[model samples]
Target: MRKTFLHIKIIFCSLVVFSSLAQSASFDCSKASSDVEKKICNTPSLSKLDEQLSEVFKPLKKQRTFQVLESEWLENVRNTCESVECLEDAYNEQIGFLSPLPLPGASASNEVKILPADKIYAQSSRPWKTVELAGLPNGKDVVERFLISAEVISGILHVVAFEGHYDVPNSIYRGSLYEYIDRHPIVQPITYTIAKDIGFQGAFNLGNNEEGERYAGIMGGTFYYREKIARNQLRGMAYKVGSGTQPQETSLLLQQWSNTFENAKSGLLFQGDEVFGELKAYYPNTPGYETIAPVDRPEVGWNIFSPIWSKSRPVLYFKNGDETIWRANVVDKTLTKIVSASDQLVIKNPTPVDLNGREAVVYLEDYILKIAVAPE
Candidate 1:
């Protein structure tokens, strides 16, 4: 998540040694006179305050002092959960059980902390989809609700797609098992043809066109998707949200036939019990688009929420597709999720970034939107 200047100040205080009384017992809410004061004294509120204070004083609390880099653990969690949820339903029937899987290194007491050096949040497992050049029995070649990585060929993007396979008797699904390679149109001569003079050496943009119908310039090109949208493009490729920015992204193309391209533009999410709706473009200035006033949707109220924001990107940009809720970045050259949403639309492009454990997923349906990962 984006580290506010206030957070930096808090970090500074965390590094120093304070008085014993300063670190003593908390206030008693039962004896508080005011509701606000009493609320602050309550268990959850008190705990939050303590955590906030501790975070601010982290630098001082630790014996070894080091640099504090911003991370987006919340964004990571939200995007990961959303993306996995997209396919969770379908995969649930295919798999044998129905329970949330624990993240790597997750324990009862210890929570995953976001570090600056962490390029991605999670890793890919076995038993994924297959990528191939020729058509399979289904003949569609492209499979929905999955993750894959491809390299740039002689000016083309080549990715190996695979369906996750379960080992019989063992009852374990080999995670992210390689399937086959699928190739789509790419710019001939690749990056060299576009900018021969510039020294740009990076992976080929094997992204889907997400924001092609609306939100002009918001999403485009694999490079733009990777840099601007980041992991949200995975959902875009999956066709969870919308395709306002680019259509080449995976998800957007999937939704093209449905013609409900602006699914991610504005929507609501029910997490546990709370409901959140996007408000970034609630009142749009552009013509041809109807403005959704808060009064019209009192449930959303005036405080329309956006996805979590990180140093790199926003979470809302990655829209939810039919089977993929939020296709996000597990790390470089890899993606992860549990499929479920057969009708959910996803915008291609618009990805997420990790900022101090705050996770954000961006999805551009008619407009760029996001969803934040709730605290553990």
Candidate 2:
């Protein structure tokens, strides 16, 4: 396993205000990994302290156990904090301790490293994966999801993450925020993640949900995503990722290449933006079509160049939640259910010639649905 080490030493800022200098620490900005290291490098005050700490650590380096103590201080005191200010305070506290800071957190006990004081202090900003949950507007889902794990005081949906479904790690948590845009159903996809450090737990206020029910603990630092959301909405993703019942399949990858949404009463069929393949659909049985925007293109008027035959007959298909498919028939312009959602089904758009025979369906990931009449 790899290890990281740092020892903070406080220096009189006045002495370095006007002196030509070199780095006092072993590491420089070029070597820093965590966000905290970057902050120390960028800020003049923190840089001076880091350099001073390096100088102090040099003399102590001759001592057998000094390096060990420095390592302990890093894990227990420094890594726990999430902000520059918090880190600065941690350094000052360490400065008051013996040589490399007493064992754990600057405690008066001679027994260092033996206590449970070793805790991560601060950290740099973390990278997060964006998960889009659609149709959830009121922020209720977010509350419900995290209510048990963390204390959700509830203002615009605030939470302190408790160990959740082992799937989400401690280093990560949902940092959340919400707002209305373009008034299109106010489908504000609240950006959120579980906070790892205490530094991110602020910018809070009492706010209300879609129902106007007031909540508490809504914090700041989640505004970077609004522009992206706005851009998506403009491009026709009316049903955005929200805190609601999202799609079972997260495969609707947004691409400028070629994806098409066909809204026939039979259902909402979506062809993956493939210049050549992959079809998906949300049938009439699936709710929330009213939530999607319409296209000027004629419905069911698309031309099908190829027809996938189940044996001389073109097939029309519908997806049953990510898995399973259904064979469908259009009666009086409405889809009548034939075969239910199943596996190994293949379907493609019905060609003008095959429209009179039988209508069926197949579409989803990895395979192209071909529905052209077989050669006579």
Candidate 3:
């Protein structure tokens, strides 16, 4: 009888320890003082989520900007949650943003194809040599969507494309950003959520200022968002441009006016006012302001959305209509059609980059991304 009683006591102690461990969170459960902390300690699922978040957020804490943002999220989002559901949603959203999702058709086994001269439409004397970079897998939902932006920085190809799934009842759409290095499988940098109502407006560009700090500008209809890109990760939360009674209109107007410039070396340049028409520059890093001389604008018919500036020449490339890509000589203000494709396959978002010693341009033809090297 004594031995049986001792065994029963041991079992009881084991159960008590297990229960306490199950209820513990990333922090000490005994020291939990606030309501949110107490709630997290008491609930098993919340405890597990808190532990998981702690693990994921551990490495990112080294980044000072991320540390600041994490504190802000804890106070603003997590602390504000009154119920378990809200807390769960907040945790999941944060985890998703921190973790990257695999790009839809980024496969290592895919081969790059070279196109013959007849397949490319360009001037006879200056025929563009083209090669297929990567393409989406054959699917119905990915048919209509196109690549949004591409930029080559320090020999790495950075691309952003529109990804969507069309279902009868619930459709989803978002932008996917990835990098291609040395023809390897595309690496997904990060995943982010877009506002449901506004959505991504198919305009994204990455540029560097004179200081060599990289910045990304994305247009989501009424609002144009800007954020810094550091260590191949989006550093912090994106902020909207413009303010006033009609902020949305101002945002788009500012974005459109800035597209006239070739690069963001001096930051985003836009016209100050319609009456004065003086050019102004806004540096996002310092939030500083300055005035500059006006730039030569392309003729009225050119679509000035996300034009890629040539690093070697005074030329800028932009998409015109559904089938044409035009190169503008900023010195002479002459527009030349450098690429033309079938109406069924839209030519969009021309990006210029120097590959080794050769100058090349990358653009989206339908769902496939193709790079064309300028003739030597």
Candidate 4:
């Protein structure tokens, strides 16, 4: 796993500064000159300390465990006391009877594998086949579906992969199913917990009818089971895996090229001036679409093609008339167009498409070149 301690530490420091100075005189901790003095000044609030510890210790709680040995131990035991013969039969004939024997081999202990000190049990399953896309700019490629097993460790669900496969060049690529599981969130479970009752406990009933036995629940209710709950949660923990839910007008289009990509929603690339002087609307489903500015920027030099969720940045697909060039974001979201000769460049009239949920903007540096415009 990539060490994110430095990043976390930086965030921690920033929060400390914001809380101390940005609020009021009562919240100020600027009086302390040294780190030791600051610690002394902040030590009075044990409750605050407890809350902070709880916040940080949640992931640790999932990691800690206790062991128990299985044993056949019962507090109380009882058996039928005595047997009596019928009064009438005893009087008539000599009463004769044989004793019954007690059953044996029922004193064994049950064994179970306990969870390790640093994990919680969760299950995930995916499709059986890999969906391949042919003629994907560079070449034809295959992407596979996957199931993952994950556990919360250090406040993050680290995906300890055991299986998966991908169709690469000539051979199949398989192994280490969730290589980046440590970074992504367990969105659905966390969201469900927040939206619904976190402490609520319940069960499932299949039903008593014969038809119900075949299905989970039909006309009647059957067996009961408890729902699983997870702790150590984060805010805004929603799942977003595809681009279909988002509007198409934004420069960032969700490209599902690799399973490793973090926020698969904003890596789309079109023309440099794709949204040049056009009216666009933000997609409601997008997290920060409302904050997008309609104002334009320089199209030349460096332009951010997509949002940077993490280290993995967007790749650029640039075309000046019939000439086309492709380059990956080497430094964050900043794009530097590379110059090249136009050869087997494919240019067709862009079917007047609607920007469903997102708006577009044309940068100042890029000249508004028409789709039919050719270089002299």
Candidate 5:
């Protein structure tokens, strides 16, 4: 009887140990075949970190850019971990990258207020207004779509529109490039014949060169292809327009081939060989280029994209994350958060405009174009 009781107690203890290991990790410990997977199952602290990382990665899995980053991390960082300590460190780093950081110096007094789409034009004390463009010349009704880019040059508004349905599969973003003079339309189709299946992926920029000649530029390809190209790769072209001259095409080399707005001294800003490399500037009229921001020291957040130039100053605005707009003064090396949405909103294409002598910003919110006037 004593022997039988000892046998029963040993079996019960073994079962408890098995159950703990099975339920600890985010993945099933029973099917854990890899060395790293086995280490995570056996270690309690590492298993907890794995669970935390899984939760943080859930919402961002659908993003293609994030997906690529995650895959690289798994192959380069997580899978190469040889010990439990290395695995723990890798998991922590990934979780931090996926999570949102606290907004720097966020306060109510300095935050820019955004009006509702329906009540944009309504009388209010808030400095918000919706962009009202006249009907297209082709008699087509102007629908509320995604504003890819917008700029005000010489008191004229140039805008590029997309289909606004980013979630849909294989939805081609073919729309007209319009020029609005004082809210009236002189719309023309800037036809994108190259890669018609994929459409444009980046912002449509309109700026002037050193000789005061105006030009228009945009990236033509899929997002993935553009993102993976090297610095020396030929990305797109810029067409020299206006000034009573014929449209002359100039090949734009490297990535981010758009011209930076600096009045009569506009130039090209692009990255180096590295994906997150040093920011370099090249003037069309100058002999050589200069470095604006080095790789070791980034002036602004690396994730900021869709640059909209300020006509009055040597400043450029970018959209950070999904809801914050950051203004970067390249000359002064200062980055300021100009706008922060109160809720979960995708604020896109922050364009600067002079509204009757009032400095204001125009951007897309839920497929509608809205403007926010700068505080005096």
Candidate 6:
């Protein structure tokens, strides 16, 4: 009963906050008539944010993208967000997008936020195939609709290919767990190579509060997918919502993949809601494995979405082969084949990096792409 009441109260408050349409960076609280206006007047955070946005809007108006966003865009977000938390999130996202890149020769901060190469959002891609699976195997076929796309988090780009299926629908059908698990759409990894010098510049704390911190350059090596290996070299910044400028950094702590190659006794994961997906999340638990795991896959390269962003439990890259790469747990060291492999493709000179959290990127076959793995 209490949970029900709390949910109701939350909705009420959300309604109370969106009852108005007039907004500005700085507004007269006394004259505030709408729920949004009143809340902004009462909330110090909102007021300060309004002031900041007011100042940012001036310079941002000159940009091409910002003009398209317009007042309706901002109003729609503010009005649609029912809770203060959601509202704040909407504001921050808007500001991030509206914030322009730094000018040439602009100064940057001395401190740098160094993430493992994997955490850095590098350019990535994956082979995509369409399939329709029964929500409950042999039960009913309703075209379980879903979409997969690359997303940027904390200023990093990530794309992960993963097997999709309905979770165990109920306990009565637990007897046929394996058969019910559909591993149809196999998610592959995006791979790329870094053969030369690499660099990471820090974010510039532009001398003024109005502009805020401009995203520093996120330097990624050559990015490509299977066929366009030579012509697909890609690098530079990938933003979640804003423009990222180059940062000032002396050096990047590199985790170089071994020129030497080795094979793992088994694949990284098996496809099942219970075990397979869970195991891939926390891979590379061993210390110093980051430098060693790159060469340990099925063949010449690694599969996509095998590596995570942490030092512990990183899945090495593998070359694609005629074998259907199976999923396995690191503890028991057992492997399960979701689908049979064809003699078409093989893994090759695989390279990988952590794209922050559980997502990682692998470069192979002269192309680059993203993969899903354990979260950070």
Per-model TM values vs. the true structure? 0.22, 0.21, 0.37, 0.19, 0.37, 0.24
Cα lDDT tens digits for candidate 4, 172-211: 3333211122222222211111112111111011110110
Per-residue error (Å), model 1, residue 232: 32
- Which regions of candidate 3 are displaced past 4 Å? 1-125, 143-149, 165-175, 182-259, 262-306, 332-334, 342-344
lDDT of 5: 0.49
The true-versus-predicted C-alpha distance at residue 204 of model 4, in Å, is 38
Model 6 misplaced stretches (Cα beyond 4 Å): 1-25, 28-31, 70-72, 103-376
Over 4 Å off in model 1, which ranges?
1-36, 39-324, 327-346, 357-359, 374-376
Instruction: Give all candidate RMSDs, comma-separated.
Output: 24.4, 28.1, 21.7, 34.1, 20.3, 21.2
Candidate 4 lDDT (Cα, 0 to 1)? 0.22
Better candidate number, 1 or 4, judged by TM-score: 1
Question: What would the per-residue lDDT of candidate 6 be over residues 61-124, giving only the tens digit for each residue?
Answer: 5322234343655567787766677767777766654554332221111111222436312212
Model 5, residue 336: distance off in Å is: 16
TM-score of 6: 0.24
For model 1, the local distance difference test gives: 0.26
Better-scoring candidate (lDDT), 5 or 6: 5
Backbone clash count for every predicted candidate, in the order shown: 127, 42, 0, 10, 0, 60
lDDT string for model 1 (1-376, tens) is 3578779778767654233223332443345564443333343434354345435434322211011111121133212333333323323322221112232331211121222332323323232221112221222322321222222223222222222233334332222212121122211211121111111111121222221222111223232211123222222332111222322343232212111123232222322112333222221232222222223233433322222212232123223222243332211212233222223543233333221233323222211122222222
Tell me the TM-score of model 1: 0.22
- Across residues 278-314, which tens digit of lDDT does each residue of candidate 3 receive? 2333433444444322233223332334455565555
Q: Provide the lowest-lDDT 10-residue window in model 5.
A: 205-214
Q: Please, what are the lDDT tens digits per residue for candidate 5 over residues 1-376?
A: 9999999999999999888788899888988999999999999999999899888777656433245456778888999999998998899878876664432232221122222223211111232323333332332433324444455444344444443223224332333333223321223333221222223334332211111222223223211112112333324433222222222224443243342443313343644221454434444444555544344443443443555566555556655555766655544445556676546766765767654344567666644445554443
